[model samples]
Target chain A: MNQQNILFTNNTAQAIDTAINNIRPNGIFVLTDKNTAVDVWPQVKAESTMMSEATLITINPGDTNKDLKSATLIWENLINGGATRHSAMICLGGGMITDIGGFTASTFKRGIKFINMPTTLLSAVDAAVGGKTGINFNGLKNEIGVFSPASHVIISTRFFNTLQKRELLSGYAEMLKHGLIDSAATFHKLIDSDPLEIDAGHMLELLKASVEIKRRIVNDDPYEQGIRRALNLGHTAGHALESLAMKKGKPVPHGYAVAWGCIIELILSHTHCGFPTNTLRNAAQYIFSHYGTPDINCSDYQDLLEFMHHDKKNISSECINFTMLSNVGRINIDRTATESEIKTALDIFRDLAGA
Target chain B: MNQQNILFTNNTAQAIDTAINNIRPNGIFVLTDKNTAVDVWPQVKAESTMMSEATLITINPGDTNKDLKSATLIWENLINGGATRHSAMICLGGGMITDIGGFTASTFKRGIKFINMPTTLLSAVDAAVGGKTGINFNGLKNEIGVFSPASHVIISTRFFNTLQKRELLSGYAEMLKHGLIDSAATFHKLIDSDPLEIDAGHMLELLKASVEIKRRIVNDDPYEQGIRRALNLGHTAGHALESLAMKKGKPVPHGYAVAWGCIIELILSHTHCGFPTNTLRNAAQYIFSHYGTPDINCSDYQDLLEFMHHDKKNISSECINFTMLSNVGRINIDRTATESEIKTALDIFRDLAGA
Candidate 1:
């Protein structure tokens, strides 16, 4: 949403150079995960001259490590490294890294400036656009965080090559959701593209489109008060399914879970918000055909409901609140659906997926 | 220095009622310490009708508990209490409660609105006015925090009735610092007033003036970029001494430490910034006569220096940065002092204390 804070550049090195030159920080703290440190840091270091003097703070890669324990570790590292209020942190990696790193920078000395260089498709389009920074606690997603945006967000599609097929697909899922929420034409374009086969240039265009969709929504409502709820259209169901999958020990990638969630929620939209049934059917067919259905059944319905109850969007103790679409680009927030209606929607998804 | 967010009121209950009416929160969570839960909550509850349904969260009283552990416990309480983005937190105690509670409220669900009801003189003039929220980590004072202001801050002199003499004096130290920084007339007025003998009405007038002084500085520079550094005149050496005393098993009251820090820093002001020697001697005589010197001697100098090294204001690794006074009312910030000059300041403090 902070248009001036984000830079879309083909050459990340040049972007980093410009940001560092402008900030003129007293010191630099670079945060990365083991995965990024090995796969991505060399390229980043080679490009930015400042990397030689920066303190490298690495954490183990994965969502499981994105917790308070990791945050405490990062805080201690920043303190021991003598990071001052004038110091700037460079977060280079996926969502987990940026979330934790941004949180660390925001809380350290009552907040220092942070520059985000998102290395994954999910982070580039989603996390980097929003000033949301946090870590999970007590098995809840983003349970603890602050709404502090990075001073600069540098997005480069070259990091896409480092992503596995599943990782790439995970980010593509959000792109689909953005399209579905933004316009019918965008939705069709996303459905028609083979995510795994997209070239760097084309994928960069898609990433920019996805980021722009989020940027507009966030700019209109940075605090998620009203219009920004549209951004959570798939997240209501998607997050529940993701939490359920994680609980079941077969954690699905966020994008895949979101892909599955979109299919189920689209059916809910048709029933609750009078969305066109044809559009719902078309959406389900395309998403399921590409990502396939998550291995969830009627048995997982209660767990999914339980997870949904804890969703930050739901302010009430009863009845799940959802962002339902009357049609593509049309959203109705704070819509409550009954348990049976939700069950029926899952059943529709099961039938569509042939599971 | 969020002028719109703060309310100075004689009727605490009416202010709270108005704040609750305006915010229309989903729920209310009240944070207090064991001391306040017994001594202060009753008065607040009787005044504010909203206290009836609010969830009560309590922690032990003291600076020792103002750490990440306390923050974690408070977060758990908020999460378990079903606090949503719409929920409002009422921080009802001194600095420790507000610091931990404000940090908890600011971070929970990426921030919920928090109201501060400062119950101690120290908090009334200092913590309640500033948007500083934090918890100590790894033996560092306020090492982790955020610059997030409360939705409303309610200050009542009636709460001062519960403070012990030491607590009252602890706050008076800061009030003196405010006077010293604001004007020569204000400084003389503060030194002349007997903190212990002053009536509640007179004390309340002084409190308002102190708060106003801080409000002006913070308003001009909320993030402490320039002029706000003047407010840190005594804090540089005060925080270092406070931390040393805390580490030494005999934690001196904050105001007492600040009073001590003022005397030492005034000497530094004279040496480095050419502050009037006669004014420094008079100020030291008044402060030491009233609050007797702390037992720290030459042996504790190294620990004090070490603690100052970790002070958040320090932008570099070398010289200690201080806010020195050009005169009683004039201040020069970001001045570096050598170890010998610092030792000389301490020696002056000791000799004046008859050590």
Candidate 2:
């Protein structure tokens, strides 16, 4: 089921053309959000002659819009536009577009072919490789979805030119996490450099490394039954904070919350997994200084815990699960943490913020 | 992906118990309709101690309720019930229950194990063997779905005692179709017998043969890419008629519609595919006499053709696709039918009704 083939190209137009020629779909549908429709679609249109004939479907640009309603809209549009099972869909936007589009394609007519042309850095590196496709349901993130991979994931850094500084920083957080989880040297190098100032050549190299780390884990455990849990090192806490922010109607960007969660989980790793205190302290200092702290505090811990209970990784309702690290690139999955320990870790996170 | 294991038993209770013990899921969810809730669940509860602890979810019985709204309700219930990724769902009812329940389980928390306990003969012989799971969307039958097989499909004949005459006759349509599409001897045997009067032992043997026929086709092409389209021999015209009936609010049961559709298509098969004229005459006479000719006539052909365009099997708008039969157990898929040809076929169908 992990059939996604990755192609990194500087000339995205050539890549898109090549893919379309190979698939020879009966029809082509391009899915985008309002933001990508303006900023990114023109470039895609200019690059491939295929866009002239492809049907375009756009949704509102936000995580809140990535719901069943949006999926229904896409399905209806595809049906109305004469989409056959042999037709192909091109998801050309950020993570929200790719996630919802992949899900729509996976389900529409009982699964059609789709290609992901991830425009934002987060999607290109993180969402592109994994076969996870879904939409948020009942105020829960990714509570409804399937493990269906794309036919192709075409990555090009050209679309980054349209991204804002904040979005770039959000994407950088995942890249930073990949480095920390897989290679201490890469983490050190990433932290030493100003993420916002990276050249295209260097950024592509970083993207390849980050995507490779995720690809290896996902390929080994496509269903997330084992080693793939390691990829959730920061996500257990990250998703909780993200959900709470969304529920409160003051949403935090996903990567920023993840960077913050990594700091808290790093502390947990130090306490339970025999992680070196000095390494944790250094990583914590860099993350806090760069990503800054989220507005959530000790008062939000209970709400966050409520969110954690609904996390897909948890088997029982009693204890929260986390992927804790014994050392960089050496981690243990399904590690349980008590509410008291979570509060203590949050305290350590706060202390590191002040320090 | 074709991993479903079929279990045949007179003692369904013991089978349920064995399956539950083998899966040993963190939680069990039983999905049933109002009818099955009253007729079948008591048997399931008495048979398996697991049901004592399982959460039971019921939906209103009918094809109209098989939609995204119902799927959303099921997902919300599962989430609220503390159903983890390790939870398993038991779809215990007819085609409607199995179809929608399978969709709910397939998408819940990115899928969980689901076992099919098909109560009606239609589901046992047709829907049970196919890994097709879905809910109808936007006024279309099975418009949104996935090809995810169940962990197990448990068949039993005890539930047949509770079915109404019409319901029993409806399920018998598929059993008849399995014969028409795969074996002429089976078709002749079924035509000679009274479906409702068959003893349990004989009925079970017929079901095993029917299920085996469908299983071979599905295993050869689980995704309906090629040979599986043969299973859609009657469905092309059958679905169009069913959708029209549902739209007009004079809904016919699925198997009856398929039985009618099979007669119409058999005529098309004779004219277009060199099928023996006498075989078509005999089969048509049997189907018309047993199922009775639907109220459809020349007036309904336009509306039925309108429905056929959206059949999910067509490649273009110009011509509707049908799986034409060359002979019993021999089919040519993706065959095109023009409006004129369709009208002629309907004319032959009307002539048969009068005859």
Candidate 3:
């Protein structure tokens, strides 16, 4: 048993049952967006059988609303409902909902118990269980946030059935990332398994495995002070691409952007970082074959670099990228890559896009 | 020679000199509100010739703005200014500015260096030195915040020369609190000095003592996981009064609210917490006679109790208050008063007011 009485469960109904039976909170605060309030929250309430005092706050969904304004409203609702430090906030939505809800609970009355009941695949497999909570500001994404552990995390596949194929694929990128950085067996299993066909029978097992992998990484470096930066492998270039897309008001979903970012960075490593050319090419081919290519060109190259400057990982005076080696399961983190090097890498992206 | 590289300086000019010589950086980010920006910031800038890159962000000065929206704007400005982790934030103004700015810096990119240059008499002795950073959420005050240390703090007595007499008297209450809680000598000094006649030279010594007292308390228990609850001696009632004031718009300044709260809690402490009646009488008489009581009646008592429900120090379900003893130089904390007892205390306030 884990020292933290914190349980990780995937079945939403079962998870709520466990929470109710174990915690028996005085009241509940269900956090959702307009989307989840209409679709996902009803399922949660029906299953949990919460009391009348249990509050529901419906907010606007997406990264845009994951901000101070939403947090203030949530705080108002929770406090008005007489929510105390002992009170629990059950976040029931996607990554944006989880981020804002978790941040609110973490800071409201200086931290309260929060549970993430993720509805989207992106949240369930990646964001739901993590303790990171943040909101975007000043054209930079997640510029302000905190590291707050949740009381528990409930990952329900019921919401996965509603996920668009693109959303499911977005989440799969992270799972693939887990495999590339740490586990080959996990990678092979993902390759073999049809995520489109993840049945009820296999759901719990899959969730457990993904969560355990994350747990181990977090356990090793909870504060992101060192080895944790490895987990940000595709993110340096990926965040820039996402922000670029966001600025254009046509933001690509995170996973695809990262998928493309990983491809280019791998090519750069093959040439600049002395990785085996064959392995780098093979990895690039596999991603391209699996997910298609990312769109980019020399014209937008400087824009990508500007986005890189906003990355949280670039703590030093200069912007740095967390590059990778050709060896499967190895990473080179905090490598100070020059602007010229990053531009050359973007050239590969441009080539993928036939730019 | 001590591990602490920066000493808390009394002179604003010298402190700026130290900071400039020590941490030479790209630019300075000075945080202030409309009130402070108009008056305090000009003085601060004049004392220290900031580089051309130094920027100013003026916010609406008040506790209500000390929420997520304010933090988000600050984060946006910092990122837009290309403030990296190396760039330092100099918080100029009162507690609200210091708390919000400190929190913004601490959370911006997972933490950055911040220097507190407090302008208000309240912030000068207390808020400017410690690294307590947070914003209020919902109806809760200081609910969403973190405990992080500052890179350095500069105490400038020059700003107090610009303060209204009422504001000076209000701050004098905290100065008295420091003496009552820890040192009889400091208490006597405050008792002897008239707020109207206080000179900058004498105020600086008192400011240094109060800052040192807070520093010792914080160093002993930085996170307030324990002992530091003693520091909250009057805040239980103080925060409620401040909140009530805020709802009405013409807010009773924080120091004034806390001063009244300290007296209310002191009277109640005598009856239930073994506090000496004489000590309570003396303290109350001194504050009430000097400050003239601000209003707290039965109508607003329930709201005050509700505010206490959100107090950060409450470990369990009960809303506890930190009540001190009659002893000249000691404090008792985290004392839970019954509902009836709190009511009785409110009655005492009403009786005193003849309301």
Candidate 4:
């Protein structure tokens, strides 16, 4: 009863309508970002009955806007809109909106029912499923947050179809990860297909299966006390690069960074867990071909390593936490690598990816 | 499985040691406030084997320090001290320390294990239990928060015995409330006793029972979706008066406000829920004789009314939420009274208490 429900529908409006009927909240507020307001909010306004009467609140679009000030603004809006425990909020847009929206809803009068409408493929496969809601605090990415899940996650292809090529690849990268760590057939099919050319229906199916991998792990360990660290597969090196890029004003999409991080981690897997060499090389080639390298050089590796040292998964000692796969669906979580080992892996990653 | 365990120990050092043993953390961080740092931290360092090795972190004491700035300082301190997910933080102080400490620990690395050492009686009976961790934000009381419980609540009277009279009365007021709401016998004994003269062991027993009432309610419904609201009893008006006093730079102890608030809410109980008049008047007499008035008049009623409007329990529509009683042990929750009814209650409260 405390966990989130996954609502898979071909149409967004029907999914939203179903969510509303189930929650039966006394009041409802839908949160969005600037991009979704113009592109997606119109669709909800024209095509949905339950959503018509809901108060629509929009914020600036981007990870930069996901901060305490935005959170404060959302809180003020919720209070002004008269949201209460009996009320429910729908977080619409990409990861940015779902993240800030979930955090705001969870803290508004100590949490109200929230339904997440993750419009972007990246969000649907990642942010919307796990309920790891947060906003960047004091120049740190996702520095302040809580582990409170949404009541429902409404996934549909209506908005995902409209995403740009870069964004599509960003999400596809994670799907590859889902494949490598889950179904080998899924990984093979993903590596074979052109992410940019996949039909919306097929992409939606892939997204659904990929997110299920995360949803299951999260359901088993919502607080990340143990096995949930499996979800951090590529995130250690990935977050470091993402943060450095953001600091340099040349931002990289989350899944893109994660994609690159996967190669390095898989190499480590091959070294430490005796993972198949062919499988690691294949995954690395796929990432490099699609996701592109993070704009980094020898100078940036030290900063990247510094960021890795602060990765949330680390134990009380000086070690980099890693989650690698010995094989598909064979997750090895709660593993650590020395800084020297991690550095060596980074060097190999750069040489192989030609970064 | 996610609930907090309670550890009742006569010796404070033994409680801390047992908590450390139970958690078996990779590292330990002990959080304290100005008062506790001087009064209790020394005892912990000198007597406890597990706590002496802990990193001692202190913040300014009192309710005013229970804000976002203080929380930020705690977070920064935690990061600087290299606290990780395997770490455990012992929150050592009154409600201020436990509330902020619980909040910080829960968010740090998406939550590490935290143990609460409620040094003050008010914290032991109220804030330290029920997982209601928060910090005041946006100039609002506990406006930012999450419902994340500590791993264990270690209750001991070593520091409580040294509490100032006002602080002791603050805790006793909630004990009286627990008595009225759940245990009439407990309520009668509390009313009959000279609160200032209660022995440490007797006070610990009363505190233990009072906290249990709250803990049971929280356990039944942690998010206050239903019956958990019963624990809100006098908090509505009480929180308003407390906030107003803090605003005026003449802060009232939380339990004093609750004691006075209990009289008003009980009066409203008589009006709306058919609560006994003899019981209401006797409670009012006890409050007025001991807790004293909130230092307000007819002019301040509007401010009090304004503050009451912001009470967290109210629903979407404009009405003041009241958790009244038909009689002692007969709780009436999820009840809303008209603004006029609340004003009338306030008026009667002034007349009876001579505020």
Top candidate by lDDT: 2
Query: Model 3 over residues A1-355: C-alpha lDDT tens digits?
Result: 1112345454567766677566666568888999888886666677655623468988998777887678778888877777766688888888898888888787776667777778877787777765778877666777777777666777656677777878887877777677666756776677677666778558667766777777777777776766766677678888898888888888788887777777666666666667666655555665666666655556778898888876877655465657575455666766667788778777765665553
* Listed models, DockQ each: 0.87, 0.87, 0.40, 0.61
When 2 and 3 are scored with DockQ, the better candidate is 2
Better model by lDDT: candidate 2 vs candidate 4 = 2
Q: Model 2, residue B309: displacement in angstroms?
A: 0.6
User: Interface RMSD for each candidate model?
Assistant: 0.7, 0.7, 2.9, 1.8
CAPRI quality band, candidate 2: high
lDDT of 4 by residue, B1-355 (tens): 3788898877878777777788888889999988789887897789977777889899998878898688889888888887766789999899999888988887776678899988888898889988888888755688767788899998877787679999988988888888898967877888999789988888778778888888888888987878877777888989988988988889999999998888888988999899999998888888888887778777788888778877777764578898899999899997888878888988898888773
Between prediction 2 and prediction 4, the one with superior TM-score is: 2
lDDT of 4 by residue, A62-84 (tens): 99999878888898888777776
TM-score of 1: 0.97
List the candidate numbers ranked by lDDT, top first: 2, 1, 4, 3
Which candidate has the highest TM-score of all? 2
* CAPRI tier for the interface of model 3: acceptable
User: How do the residues B65-112 of candidate 2 rate in per-residue lDDT, one tens digit apiece?
Assistant: 999988888998899889999999999999998999998899888999
Top-down TM-score ranking: 2, 1, 4, 3
**Model 1, range A13-50, lDDT digits (tens) per residue?**
88998898989999999999998998989878977779
- Model 2: which residue pairs collide? none
**Superposed Cα deviation of residue B310, candidate 2 (Å):** 0.1
- Please provide, for model 1 over B1-355, each residue's C-alpha lDDT reduced to its tens digit, 9 standing for 90 to 100: 3453677777889999888887899999999999899998887787667987799999989999998888889988988898877899999999888898889898998989999999989988888777989989999888889988888898878888778988898899899999989999988898888888899888888888999998888889888998889888888899998899888898988888888888888889988889898888888888888788787888999988889889999998788888888998898988998777888888988998884
Which segments of candidate 1 are over 4 A away from where they belong? A1-4, B1-4
Over A109-161, each residue of candidate 2 has an lDDT whose tens digit, in order, gives 88999999999898998876688999999888989999899989998888898
